[model samples]
Target chain A: MRRSMLFIPGNTPNLLMNGDVLGSDAIILDLEDAVSPAEKDSARILVRNALKHLHYKGCEIIIRINPVDTEYWQKDLEEVIPLKPNLIMPPKVSCAQDVKTVSDYIAKLEEKCGFEKNTVKLIPLIETAMGVENAFQIAGADERVAAMFLGGEDLTADLRCKRTKEGNEIFYARTRLVCAARACGIDVYDTPFTDVDDLDGLYKDAQFAKSLGFTGKASISPRHVEGINEVFSPTQAEIDYAHEVMETIRIAKEQGKGVVSLRGKMIDAPIVERARQVIEMEKAMFGGVEDDE
Target chain B: MKITANAVAGTLESSDVYVKVEPCDTLEIEIESVVYNQFADDIKASVKEVLDELGVESGRISINDKGAIDCVIQARVETAIKRAGGNK
Candidate 1:
């Protein structure tokens, strides 16, 4: 039920152990980019131990393992997959085959570890241009993928574009990723807003993210989590409006009417669907904000 | 240790997650709970850190102590964010 996922460096034991203290819908213990080459094994050991020792209820604990192409991935997965995290985020996923490959790896690993095959889910990150282009295929490749995220910082670098604070350079890519995820019926997460000090900017960007149809967002800092959660989530006004629209539609249907009007605005099936989506968004955010329908 | 994402279970004391929108676009969070008091500063700091990290501007926040753990505070903040429409 977490809408904003906070990424804490894997080596930072304080943050990792106390991440529930930070207000993220989920927390990612990063054993990938956040861990330098020297700290790799130590970070993994720390995270694996912490995952075993701590109990962060209500917040999902996801481990972002190193990408399959990396030298450390096999060892990383060997140590991590058995911890039974809420989910596993596979970095730098490029295509359907990449997802299938990881799924196969997890399946094999599960048997070796005596765990249920595919008990854990994957959240592939579309961090590269090729990954973005193949996002749909990647998402649809395996049911083990619970959702997917856009890694715009890396994607921008791969595309050879400078990232502006306004996020102008990646608008097209972001839209494409969202469209791809929605089309495939999987949840889509927007890239993190990097300006930790700029709350207003974060706020505006979050609103922009919501309007773009992303279900959730990533956060480099815990501060961005609430903002992202707030921005991407449906407002009470929006939720209530959605309820009224749906209720009106239900009444119209009860009276055998198809197209109807709510406060003089024409209400139709698309409107009902949109309203239903908003209500679902509200529920996803607040957990209790759902329309009876 | 934290609690599960379960039902309201019991409200120990009739409780609420207090929130006020400031005139200056700051989202002020104050959690009033009969249960908030039993928790330590680390837990309180955890709550404050979430509000601070969440990019709330020009707001004053106070969590009324109730005997809530780290997880409950986190869940309450998430609830506040949702109530505020995740105003982002």
Candidate 2:
């Protein structure tokens, strides 16, 4: 799972070329709202060529195409589908049909370009109340969908609610998105923290999202990546306890025991499962170096 | 391909290069770059390479560079050439 997905303006050449080195787990080359209308065509060309030419150093390349209803999205798909971005993020997705529209177009592009089928994934941004209510359907709309992202700014605007750093107004929508994504068995990413200069607020917001079970957070700037990554990653103490729990469970299994105890506390199946998840998460983040004997 | 009309691509922004192409009897390439004295030869070579690849023999290519790298330069030049040739 990604801890942070950095959004870089697709038309900004310097950012597009250097986004991978910013330490984000994924880099989003955004051709949607981040780009101006006059530069839409130019941005599409730049993003397509960037995908064709640049290597993102193992960071998952996610291109945020313009909304499905726009004229720019089809052209964006035509230009970048052959290049095979890791994910195509459709912004302001309101229903399952929005996801299907992009998916069907992608299938056609795959057949025409002869690229490997199903290589391009989709992550629809849930921005409206309809999108949040239909989140599960959208998440399960296509097998190609890997995750769903909650777009708080646009969502608040759509809901006619005030957006504050505490994010109390969006709590219901955020929790609903998490539940929908979990029910669909796909990851969920929280919206970006807009206050770039307020690292403390960013940290608190990221921690809040993590508590809500978001797998990652979107970053508007590279400066926020480090904070989000730290918040999402398992701590050393948690990793050590997970290791101990696993070892205890393994010993119990060897002894033909169904119940296990570690540090005077009985370990249940759920505890053991959580331990395994923590270990797996640690490995995914640290490249399995923590798993070394 | 020969340039038939005036065409331009890209913008005069930082890390971007603005390219202008117009019809000319003889090829004349001019560049104004932030790093003109340092990487002028590399930039000129990149532009020439793209011109050769497009098979454009005679055209006046004016490049207003703002420290764009080779890839950006090549993309801008190719786009300008395509526009000049009335392809897009």
Identify the candidate with maximal lDDT: 2
Per-model DockQ: 0.02, 0.46
RMSD of each: 16.1, 2.3
Q: Estimate candidate 1's alpha-carbon lDDT, on a 0 to 1 scale.
A: 0.74
Model 1 per-residue lDDT tens digits across residues B19-82: 2322233444455556445545565576666556665444444454345445444544543433
lDDT measured at residue B24 in model 2 versus the true structure, 0 to 100: 95
Q: Where does model 2 exceed 4 Å of error?
A: A289-293, B1-5, B52-58, B82-88
For all candidates in order, the CA lDDT equals 0.74, 0.90
Shift in Å, residue B29, candidate 2: 2.6
TM-score of each: 0.73, 0.92
Clashes of 2: 0
Q: What value does DockQ give for candidate 2?
A: 0.46
